[model samples]
Target: MSATALPAGHALRRPVLDDLPEVYRLLVAHDVSVLGFPDLTEDDLRDEFTEPGFDPVTDGWLALDADGVAVGYAWACRKGTSADVDIDFYVHPDADPGLGGCLLTVVERRAGEIGRELGHGRIRAMVGCYRVALGEAALLAERGYTVVTTFHRMRVTLDGDLADLADLADLAGPPVPSGVTVRVCGTDEDLLRAAHGVKEVAFRGHFGTVPQSFDEWYGHFAKRSSTDWSQVWYAEFDDEPAAMLLATNAFVETDNAGYVQALGVHPRARGKGLAKLLLRISFAEMSRRGRTSAMLGVDTNNASGALSLYESVGMRPVLEIDVWRKAITLG
Candidate 1:
């Protein structure tokens, strides 16, 4: 594509590592405008660019204003040629609305080419935006995408005396019924496998469940330098594993917050208070470490009443994100 083809007064170019600083700045601007906080970091952008499926050369683009300043950016990728592709794009508040659509058009076009290369007849493109991004929402809807689900960023302050940590140990609720015990994981391979198993079994029935092989799942966390393996926990009933909690310190270094990356209870263990026990365990541990808070994201309409459960434990919704999807077919 040439500058002449771009929306008038805008120029598009493929992104390179040299553009990281500019990209990061644009992202921060977008985040501050949309979330009132700079929720992104240079490391986050680096990780996304290095992710397994991302191809920087063909999968990302930067839009510059007439003055040659980057004002918008977009990227698209799929996991191992999967038909389902994830797309993300950001535009500076001062950019032309047409620039946003222009980048989105390029992203969708690249997604289609990727789907074809993967031997898929059609591609399912998924995108997310803050609920307050009304213009983006309308743009997506007008382009045939429909809202499929919503997620809430939940958080709770973790403040208590070290000696009182014991009392806060079970914020989720009372201990699992008799014959059940929960404990954090160590660096044992068997233990990691068991934790992954519990998560797989527990979330199989969840909405939009996409099954990832064990290696793929574990590899993801292993690659994240901020993940804390010790924060991973498992709940056992009568010596049989039944639930798991995989957490990370990703937010700790940036926001001074502990994060629950994944939490699940096996179907057979439902209603046993295991979920609540694991949650409180996290709160207690985070507080003991002197973290200011703990946070996690949950589906707003979760069939398992997860929203109510989190609220019951004093975690309030701090932000909302909506996922939209559109089908792409190319002749």
Candidate 2:
């Protein structure tokens, strides 16, 4: 990738923990301009600093203007030593126009370096763009990135009527299939491991999925401030773990919504109502906790018909994000 120089009066450097507040502001500003509301939390910003296999010093960048105020930020993260890298960058809406492209070039170069270090001859860098950000999408297209798939941010409001329905359903007992039972995974190591196993098996064929060891998976989630053990649930068929769901407080800070981070059903357990049942249970719990809504993201092209399932549960698309991909040949 060719280098793009930043505008005059701007300086770029590695981001440090001290830059967290400024960087968070830059991100929120960018999102607010595009989506009309902030989609990130300070905790989410902090979690990125310690993501697995990510080195903020080398893989991240912060751009400041003449007064040394943060105007742009970017980072690239490798997926478990694989050639696939996830990248993201943001420029304040009022910042100079060229800052975003400059930051993207820097992170793309870093992604290439990561691929070479992994001894891979080719690599793929993926980024997500808000569907409404036409200018941003045009810039990415100019740099050779192409849309791979679209993802929808789906949400369901937990209003009084829905809350009442959820409570009635709970009183009627879980609507799970015969021989299947669902319960929270709690803090039990074995149960957590089982949940991890179910996630791996269930998402094996998902688009852009990279296999991760149980320790890797657990460490990644355990270190996140949004993680709540009480929100993790697993379903078993005939006493054998068959499905898993992980919920987090990701949207609680900004949207007052409970976020379903992951929901997967083992192949052996497909065709059963386990997934829907877990979602209903989650809605009940979120309502009980006084959350106004629940949200999750799903790939529109998911082969499992996840979009339909979510829609059947009264969830509607609130926003759309397009996944962009660019493949590079490593030297």
Most accurate candidate by TM-score: 2
In candidate 1, where is summed lDDT lowest over 10 consecutive residues?
160-169
> Which runs of model 1 end up more than 4 angstroms from their true locations?
1-5, 79-81, 160-177
lDDT of 2 by residue, 147-237 (tens): 9999999998875455534423452335666898787888998888899999999999799898999899989999999999999998899
Model 1, 1-331: lDDT tens digits are: 3312566777788999989999999999998887788886687787777776687898999999989999999999885657888897899988876777777888998899889889999889989889998888988988899998999999887764333345354544344568987766767778888988998888875765677777887777777676778999988888887999988887886788899988898888789778878888888778778788889999887888888888877788888999999998877
**What TM-score goes with each of the models?**
0.90, 0.95
Distance from true location, Cα of 321 in model 1, Å: 0.3
Candidate 1, 58: how far from true, in Å? 2.7
Best by lDDT: 2
